[model samples]
Target: MIAALGLAELKLLLRNRTAATLAVLMPLAAGLYFALGVGGEDDSWTMVVTLQLLFSFGFTVYVTVTTALTARRQDLYLKRLRTGAASDVVVLTGILLPVVVLGLAQALVLLGVSMAAGAPLPTRPDLLVLALIGGAAISCAAGVCTSGLTGTAELAQITTAPFFFAMIIGGLMGMSGGEDAWVFLIPGGGLGTLTGAAWGGPTDHVLEALASVVAWTAVATALSTRFFRWDPRT
Candidate 1:
């Protein structure tokens, strides 16, 4: 049942040309832009990895999931799913699975492009993998919370902006070594730390980074549990 719903969601996602383009093209384009235009003569894998995370996990995942969830709620699709035999977890997971998969694929594509463009392979592959998993999970849960506040599909972009920008800016700052201690409280800060560690930048903050990611994930999950609405907003 979950598989069937996931397939249906995938089809729905593909049919939406705008969403499909953003999910596929945006990450690729951003990666190439940063890799070629930004990295310059210094083979900086940090820039590549940071940009990939920002574009893939930050923008693409958050916006796509929020928009999709908002559309489904507005169209009564989520409400209909609630009436089915699928449990809440299965229903929500099925709806979100495609976006999650796409985000991971985009991450891999970005990594490949970065490597081809002269960025070295991750120095700490484990840290990179951890960052990717944590970032994706955080983005998906954030999207659910964002969708709860969105009144319509058209409003999703605006509604998701604060969270998206927070991640982008905080991530950039964290990656650049702006250590205020509080930056790690933001969703993307831990990801930045982990990604930086992946490039052999620092390992002293790994535990803090992991804790930050886990903490944000917990907050986002709690928000979604409390506020996520299946039906359209009145």
Candidate 2:
């Protein structure tokens, strides 16, 4: 049942030109530009790759999920899905699975681009994977939380802006090579640290970074559970 719903959601996602652009083309374009077009003697590959992952999660996963959920609710699709045999968890996962998958795929592609542009290979593949998963999970949960407050799919652009910017800013702060403890409190900060460490940037505080990602994921999940709606807001 989840597979069927996921396939349906994927089809719907591909059919919507605007959503498809945002999910598929936009991130790829921006990431390729960042990896290939931008260059500086002082540029850290870790920072560039971290920003790429941030963009993939922020626009592809986060914005797309919020838009999809609010659009489905407005169309009564979410309400109808809940009436079926599938559990709420299954339904929600099915709807979000494609977006998450797309986000991860984009992350890998952008990482490859960075590597092709002469960035060193990740020394810690496991940590890189963990960062990717944590980033996607947090972004997905935050999307669900945002969807509850989004009256329309069109409004998701405005609603998702705050966290989207936070993600970028956090990445910048994490890559600043400083010891600012408060940086990890932001959305993408810990993920950036983990990504950097994966690429041999710094490993002294990996556990702290992991804990930050876990904490953010927990908070976002809790808020999503508390606020996510299956019906459109009136």
Score each candidate by Cα lDDT: 0.85, 0.89
For each of the candidates, the C-alpha root-mean-square deviation to the true structure, in angstroms, is 1.3, 1.3
What are the per-residue Cα lDDT tens digits for candidate 1 across 1-234?
Answer: 888999999999889988888777877788778877777454366966787887898667889899899999999999999998999899999989988988998888878877787887778999889989999999999999999999988888788889998998777766754356888977698888888888877688788888888999999999998889988899
Error of 2 at 96 (Å): 0.7
lDDT, candidate 1, at 15: 93
For candidate 1, which ten residues in a row score worst on lDDT?
171-180
Task: Tell me each candidate's TM-score.
Answer: 0.96, 0.96
lDDT of 1: 0.85
Clashing pairs counted in every model: 0, 0
Task: Tell me the lDDT of candidate 2.
Answer: 0.89
